[model samples]
Target: MKTKHPYRLGVDLGGTKIETILLDPEGGSLGRERTATPRDPDGPTEYARIRDRVHTLIEAALGKVPHGHACTIGIGIPGTINAQTGRVQNANTTGLIGHPFQQDLETRLGRPIAMENDANCFTLAEARQGAAKGYDLVFGIILGTGCGGGISINGKIHSGRHLIAGEWGHFSVDPEGARCYCGNRGCVETKISGGGVAQSFFERTGQRLTLEEITEGYRQGDPQCRSAFEQFLDDFGRCLGGLISVLDPDAVVLGGGVSNIDELYTLGVEQVRRYAFHERIQTPILKHQLGDSAGVIGAAWIGK
Candidate 1:
C-alpha cells in the first residue's frame, strides 16, 4: 500500500523514555525528540499520563512537517499485542498490561497506526539498513536488563500466528534452573541476560557484582569471575547454537547493552559452532549498526 503521507513518524515507548523521530522518503531524519516517560503516584493514572505524554511527543514531531502534508505513524512497544484479546501483554512496564493500548492510541491520535514488538522493530531496522542489510533471514537479539529476540524475513517481520515468533528469551534451557517471572524454570533469559549474569556471579562468589564488574574481573583473570563468565559464554553458545540448528538464519544481529562486548563475536561464535549440528557454522553474527536508534527507525519502517 502506498503511504498517504510525505513523512513517516516512529515512536519508541521505552521504560524510561519516549522517543519520536520523523523520516523522509530517502531515510533522512527530519527531526527527532525524546522526553522522560511520565509517572503518576496512582497506579491507575500512570497509564493515562504515559498516553498523554506520547500524544504530546507525536504532536511536537508532526509540527515539523509542512502544514499541508500528512504523515504515517508507527509505534514499537516493549511487549506484544495479544492477538486474541487485543490488549498489550508481557511488557516490562506493568501499567500497560492488559490495556487496550492500540485502540486508545488510535482513538486519541485520530488515525490508523502500526504497532509491533520492539524486538521485531529492531530486527526490521537491522534487516532493512543496519548490520543485517541484504540478508534474507535475520535474527535480532537484545541482551540488556533482559533478553528478547525477533525474526525478519525478506525485509518483513514474521511475527507468527501467536505473535511470539522470536521470543527466544523464554525458551526453557534448563528444567532445574531458577524460576522465571513467566512461571518457567531455567529460561534462556535467566541464564544469559545482564541480570542473569550478575545473579550467577553472586551465587558463585557470594559477592554481588554488576555484569560490567564481572566482565572486568574476568579480564584480570579473577578465577571467580572467569568461572561465571565462562559459564555465560557456554550458555550463550548452547542456546544460540541450538537456535541456529532450528532456523539457520542468514545472519544474526546483536543489540542492547551487552552486545558491546567485543568477545561475543569471537569466542561466542566458536562456542556456537561447537554446539551446532552443522560440521561448519558460517553465519555472520554482527553488531547493530544503527545502535539505539534502530528501534525507532524500525518502528518508522513499519509504515512502509
Candidate 2:
C-alpha cells in the first residue's frame, strides 16, 4: 500500500543549480528535477529571485507525487541559518546572507519546513543510508570547487551549539598562506579544494591547469603536476588528520570531484596516518556511495 501521508520532498539549493526530489516512505525516489538557480537583474531584493525559483521547484516536485499525497519540504542551503537572527549567514552566495530565508520560505510554501547546510545534508545522507551507514559517528567531506564538511552522530546531524560544528574548510591550516575570502590565511579549503590545487599549481608552474589536467599530468609523471598533487595530499593529510584527532569518527566519507582521485584513499591515507596523533590510524576513509545525490536525498530525510 502507498504511504498515506508524510511524503518527503527535498531541495538542494546549490550555488549554480537547484535540485528537488520526491521520496516515498521506503526512501525510494519517486521523482527528481533540476534547474539553474534563477538570477534577477532587476529585482530589488536578492533573495526574491531564488525564493521564487525554490517555490516553483517545490511545486513541480509535489506534482510528481500520487494524488492526495503532499510532501513535507526540506531544503539544503550553501550556508547556515543564524541562530540569533534566523537569517542566512556565511553563504558564499552573498545575496542569501542576512535574508530571513527560513521564514520567507515557510510563508511562501504555507507550511513548516526543515533547512540545513548542504554539507550537513551530505553527512546525514551518508550516515543514514550511504557509505557511512551503520556507523555511529560519521564525518562527510566535500572537496569540490570548494571544501566543506559535516558531522552526523547516530544518523542525525550534529549542528553544534553555534551551528558551525563541522565547518572544517575554514579552519586555518597555514597562518602565512594565501588570503581566503573568509578573511583567513591558509584555510584548509585554500589548500585541498580543487580550485585551491589548481591555483597552487598555477602559482608554482605559472601554467594554468584545471584540476583534471593536473591529475592527468600527475598520472603521466609530470614533475610540476606531481609536486602539486603531493602538496594536496600533504594538506589533506594534515587537515583531515587533525580533524580525526579531535572527532575520531567511525568513518570519513569523501564526496566532490577531487575525491575521485584514487590517491586519496591510498597515498592520502598513508599521509593521514603519518600526521594523525594515533600511532595506528584505523579509521576508514571511504568515498561517498551516493555521489551527487547525497545532498538531495539527505534533504528528504531531514524532512522525514
Candidate 3:
C-alpha cells in the first residue's frame, strides 16, 4: 500500500463554503476543516477574497502535516475549469475564472498543485475509495445548487475529448422546458437540482420554502412536502434512466443535499428501472458514502 509520493492536501471550493483536508498517501484523512467562502459583493473584490481564502485553507491544512513534511495540493473547484491552464469558468463566482490558481498556490505554498471540477473530484473519490471503489467506470452526480457530474474510469476521470465528459446534469432533457443556470432550457439539472426542487415545491404547494425546509417537512410527513419530494424523485429517476442508457456504468452514485433523503436511493433505483435498457441486468443507484468530504478527498486524488 505504500505510494511513491508523500502525504497531500485536498480542498473543495464552493460558492458559499470551502473545505480543506489533510490526506495521507493512502487516502486516509488526517485532519479537516470548513470555512465560509469569500463573497466580494462585486467582481474584483470577490476575486481577491477567494484567492485569500484558498491560501488560508491550504495553509491551515498544510499546518497539520508537521513543520518539515512536504506535500502536494489539489483543489476541487465548482465550475468549468481549464485543467491545462487551471482557469475556472462559471457564473456563480467571479475573480476565480481563468485565474492561475494552481501556479499561484504552488508559489505561495511551495508544493505542487492540481485542480479539477468539484464533481470530477467527487467521482475520483468514490471510484478510488468510496461507494464505487471496485468499479472501472463510475459517474458521480451532484444534485445541489446546480446539477453537475464527474466521470471516472479505473480511478481516472474520463474528461472526454473536450474535457467535458461528465456534464450529464447540463444535458438538455427538455429543450423547451425550464431555463438553466448554464443558459440552457430544459436541462435535466433545472428539473432536479436543489434550486429546481425548491421551485417545484413552491409551484406544487403555493408556498415558498428552501430546499432543506422542504426536505425536512417531507421527512416529518407533511403531505404536501411528501408530494413535492415524490415529484423530485420522479424527475431524478428519469434523469438517471437517461444517464444509464448512455453510460451503462457499473454503478451510479448520487450525492449532494437531495441524496440525503431517507429512501431516495431506493425510490430512484426503482424509478430508473422503468426506463433503463437492461431489464436482465439491474444497475444499482447508491447514495454517496463519503458525504460532502468526497470532494476534498477526491481533490487530493487529482492526477493520481
Candidate 4:
C-alpha cells in the first residue's frame, strides 16, 4: 500500500505473546519486541494490563521515528471485533473476548488504529509478499495453539458482513468428536491444532507430549505417538480438504509453529486430495516464506 508515512508500527496480540514490529516503507524491520501476554484471572484487570502493554510497545516504536515523520498503527488480535457491539469476540485469549479493545486503545493513544484478526493479517502478509505472493486468491490457515483461517484477495482482506468470513475452524465436522472451548463438539480446532492434538494424545496415552515430541516419536516408531500422530494428520487432511472444497483458493499458505512440520505439505496434502471432492487437486499448499513475521507486517499494511 502507498502510504504517506515512511514508518509503520504493527502489533500482534497472540494467545501466548504480544509482539510489536516497526517497519520501514521497504518492509525492513526497524525494531521488534515480545512479551508474555498477561493472563491474570481477573479478566478486567488483565484486559487493562494487555492494553497498557500494547500502549507501551507502540510508544517505544513511535520514539524511534524522526521528529517530523508520521506513522500508522495497526494491531492484529486472535479475535475479530464485533461490528455491532464494537467488542472483541471469539478470541482464544478469553480476557479479550468482550472488551472494547480498539476503542480503548485508540482513546489511550489519541489516534486511529486499524485492528484485524491475526489470521487475516497473516493471509494479507502472505498474499502481498510472502509465500502466496503471486496468487490472486489466497487462503492463509493458522494451525498453532489454535486453528484459524483467513481469506485474502489481491492482498486485501475480505472480512464479510459479520467480520467472520473465513472462520472455518469452528465448523464442526464431527458431532461426537471432542468438546471445544466454544461449547461445540468436534470442531476443526479440536482435531488439528497443536493444543488439540496434544490434549487428545494425553487423554488417550495417559502421557503428556509436546507437539514436536509427538512428531519425533512418530518418526522414531513409538506406538502411542505413531497412532496419535497418524490420527492428527488424518484430521488435518479432512478439515483442510473440506475447506479447500468450499473456498478453492488459488493458494493455501500454512503458518504458525505447527506449519514447521514437513509432513503437512506431503502427507497432509495427499490426504487433502483423498478427502477433497475434486479428482484433480491443483491448488498449491505452500509453506509461509515470512515465518513468524507475517502477522505483524500484515498489520502494518492493513493500517493503511
Please name the candidate that would achieve the greatest TM-score relative to the true structure.
1
The lDDT per prediction is 0.90, 0.89, 0.80, 0.90
The RMSD (Cα, Å) of candidate 2 is: 1.9
lDDT of model 2 at residue 64?
Answer: 76
Q: lDDT at 131 for candidate 4? A: 95
Could you tell me how far off, in angstroms, the CA of residue 182 lies in candidate 4 after the best superposition? Answer: 0.5
lDDT of 3 at 290: 90
Estimate candidate 4's alpha-carbon lDDT, on a 0 to 1 scale. Answer: 0.90
For candidate 1, write residues 1-304 as lDDT tens digits. 4446468899999999889999976688998888887766447898888888888888788888777776888899899999999899998887888898988988887888888999999999999999999999999999998899999999999999999999999999999987888999999999989998898778767999988888899999999989888888999999999999999999999999989987798898999999988999898999999999999999998863
* Regions of candidate 4 where Cα sits further than 4 Å from its true position: 1-6
Q: Candidate 2, overall lDDT?
A: 0.89
Off by over 4 Å in 3: 1-3, 63-70, 83-86, 107-111, 211-227
How displaced is residue 118 in candidate 2, in Å? 0.6
Number of residue pairs clashing in candidate 1, backbone atoms closer than 3 angstroms, sequence gap of 3 or more or interchain: 0
Residue 289, model 1, lDDT = 98
- Residue lDDT tens for model 3, 45-128: 787678788998877777777655557778888776665665677635665766776667777876667778889999889888
Give the C-alpha miss distance for residue 64 in model 3, angstroms. 5.0
Model 1 ranges off by over 4 Å: 1-5, 40-42
Between the candidate structures 1 and 3, which one is better when assessed by TM-score?
1
After superposing candidate 2 on the true structure, give the runs of residues whose Cα lies further than 4 Å from its correct spot. Answer: 1-5, 40-46, 64-70
